[model samples]
Target: MNVLVLYATVEGQTRKIAEHVAARIEGQGHMVVLGDVRDPGFAVPGTFEAIVLCAPIHMGRYPEAFVRFVTDWKTAIEAVPNALVSISLAIHSDNAEERAEAEAYPIHLQHKSGYHPASVHHAAGALKFLEYDFFKRFLMRRIAGKEGGPVDTSRDYEFTDWAALDQFIDAFAGQIAQP
Candidate 1:
């Protein structure tokens, strides 16, 4: 399959996940074009089989720029099998409300982005204190504390489950290969 993995990131965790996704697809003998949605330079070739959109959660939302980009090219995206992966710390929260917060973007994309993706993957994001500013680091730690999550800001917390991600990708790959 010809696949495009477009993503947006603030602290680079989303980018890492995108790379992992692309690598998994490539390992299955698929051609993958991984690009940032912020400045997607390549034209969407009409022959592509699938496209995967990924973005990190910031302030409880996916980047507006990415939303705009996808909206503007909805026709091209709709022409292929597609999936969306939303990365957020909220995804790790066992609380129903926190999980709802994590699903907000994917819900919006499904109903508003005008593209019906074949699948949706919600993955927990990382907390990279080393990449955050003092205020952000403090805020995140406090929020984590409230949620009974990791409070140590001296290091990082990665909630992503690689095995689960692989399983999701493999399932999507199967969908793309269907006649």
Candidate 2:
């Protein structure tokens, strides 16, 4: 099978997750093409049998570029076996409402873009304090403290569960391999 793993990232964690997804899908004996949605040359070549679209939620929404991409390619995207990896730090929150909000982001994106994915995976994002500017770092630390996440701004914290991600990939691969 051929798969396209595309992503839109801010602060870089979503890119990292997309790379990992591409590598894992390729490792499962499928051909994979990975690209950033913001790349000037990025295009869906119509050769992929499956796709995994990943994007992170910042503030309250996905990047405008990501929303635009999905809206533009809605028909082609929905024609294939596609999945969504919705990355958000709120997925790791101790509060149930936060987690629910994180899960609902993909739904909102679907409603906005008219691209409903076959499956949705909610992945916890990271807090890259080391990569943030002073203001962002301060704001993130405050939010982390309020959410019961690690508030140590001296380093970054990753909440992605690789094992769970692998399971999702494996299942998707299996679905694609079916007749």
Candidate 3:
């Protein structure tokens, strides 16, 4: 299987996830390309046998650029075995409603872009407190405090579950590798 791992990131965690996904696909003996969708030269979706699109949720929605990319390439993207990696802090919330909100984000994206992915994986993102500006840091701190999440602005905190992500990649690779 030839795989394309496409991603757009606000806090950079999605890029890391996409890299891992691409590496995992390659480890499975498939050809893989990792593309930052923000790049002007990012490859089109049709060229790949499988695709994993990773996007982060900022203020409850994905970046507009990523949304537009998928909308524009919906036909080509849908033609392949596509999976979506939705990255957000809400997915790690102990609150059930918050988790549901995180899970429902992909549905919103699909409805708006008319691109129905073959699979979806919800990934917990990090609080890049050190990378955020003053306003962003303050806002994230408040959100985190409210959710009983990490509030230390001095350093970053990651909430991604690597084992689960690996399992998802293995399953995806197995499915795509089927003759």
Candidate 4:
């Protein structure tokens, strides 16, 4: 199948995840394209057999630019077999409250935008202090400290679960295979 995997990232974690997804799909003998939704000149082909849209949560919200892109291309995306995934720290949290908040975020976006995708995945994001400024590093470390993760600002951290993402993609592949 021809798949389009488009995403937007704040600190580059989501982009890496998206690339991983694309590589996996390609390895499965499918054609895939990866693009940033923020780039206004994104050349999405109309003949794509399936689509996967992804974005990372930042400050409790998705990037405004990505939201607009999805909203604007809702019909185009919906016409094909499509899925969405929201990456966030909440997905990594062991605390019930944090998980609930993270789960609610993508639902809220779906409700508000009225873009009901075939599948939705909430994957854990990362905290890369090595890529942040002083304040960002401190804030991320503080958040991580509360979540019982790494508090040191000298290194990076990732929480994405590849097995789960692969399963989700395989399911989509199956759906498109159905007659």
Candidate 5:
């Protein structure tokens, strides 16, 4: 199977997650192509048997580039077995409402883009305090403090679950292998 893994990232965590997904899928013996949505030279739709799109949530929304890509390619994307990996710090929040809000991001994207992925995975994102500017760092620290996340802005905090992500890739591979 040929799988294309494309992503839109804010603080680069989504790109890392997309890279891991590509590696895992390749390890499963499928040919994988990884690309960024912001690039003009990404793989087009009809070439891949399966596709996985990943994006990070910032300020309660996905990046505009990602939304535009999905909107423009909705038909080709829906023609194949596709999945969405939505990365958000809210997924790591202890608050139920925050987590629910994180989950709803994808639904909102679906409504806006007219593309509904067959599978959706909500993965916890990272807090890249070291990479943020002063204003963003201050704001993120406040948000993290409220959500009971690590507030120490000296370094980064990653909340992604590798095992769960591997399981999702395995299941997706199996799905493509059938019929």
Candidate 6:
């Protein structure tokens, strides 16, 4: 299958995840086209047989541009096999409320945008202290402190589970390869 790995990112973590997904798909002997939805002249979602869309949540929601992209492309995307990778720091939180909030985000998105992907994976995002400006860094530190996450702003922290991601890709590939 020809799969499109489309993404929207803030601070670049989601882009990195998109590239990883594309690589996994290609490694499974399928064709892959990776693109940032913000880029000009990105291939239309309708052209791909399958798609894996990645976007990060910031301040409790996806970037407005990402919402717009989904609203515009959902019809085409829903016609084929598709998956969503919703990245958020909240996904890895010990707090049950925070985790539920993280999980509900994608459903709310689907409600608003009418894009019901066949599979949804909640991926934990990174805390990119090095990339943020002063206020963002300070706010993130407070958030991390409250949540028992890493508080050292001198370095960034990542919480993605690579083995689980690989397992998901392998399973997805298997599903696609079956007759």
Tens-place lDDT per residue, model 5, 48-126, is 8999999999899999999999999988989999999999988887789998999899999989999898999989989
Superposed model 3: Cα runs more than 4 Å off: 40-42
Report how far off residue 27 is in candidate 2 (Å). 0.6
lDDT of 3 by residue, 1-179 (tens): 77889999988899999999998889888988889888838566878888889999999999999999999998988898889999999999999999999999999998999988889999999999999999999999999999998888899999999889999989988888552
Clashing pairs in 2: none
Against the hidden true structure, what lDDT does model 1 obtain? 0.84
TM-score of each: 0.92, 0.96, 0.97, 0.93, 0.97, 0.96
Error of 6 at 132 (Å): 0.8
Q: Cα lDDT for residue 103, model 6?
A: 97
All models: lDDT? 0.84, 0.89, 0.90, 0.84, 0.90, 0.88
> lDDT for model 2, on a 0 to 1 scale?
0.89
- lDDT per residue, candidate 6, 1-179, as tens digits? 88889899989999988889999889878998988888826566888788889999999998888888989999899888888999999999999999999999999898888888789888998999999999999999999999999999999999998778878877777777542
Q: Candidate 1 vs. truth: CA RMSD? A: 1.9
Cand. 4 TM to true fold: 0.93
Q: After superposition, how far is residue 107 of candidate 1 from its true place, in Å?
A: 1.4
User: Candidate 6: lDDT of 77?
Assistant: 90
Model 6 lDDT at residue 139:
97
**What is the Å distance of residue 45 in model 4 from its true position?**
6.1
Give the winner by TM-score: 1 or 4.
4
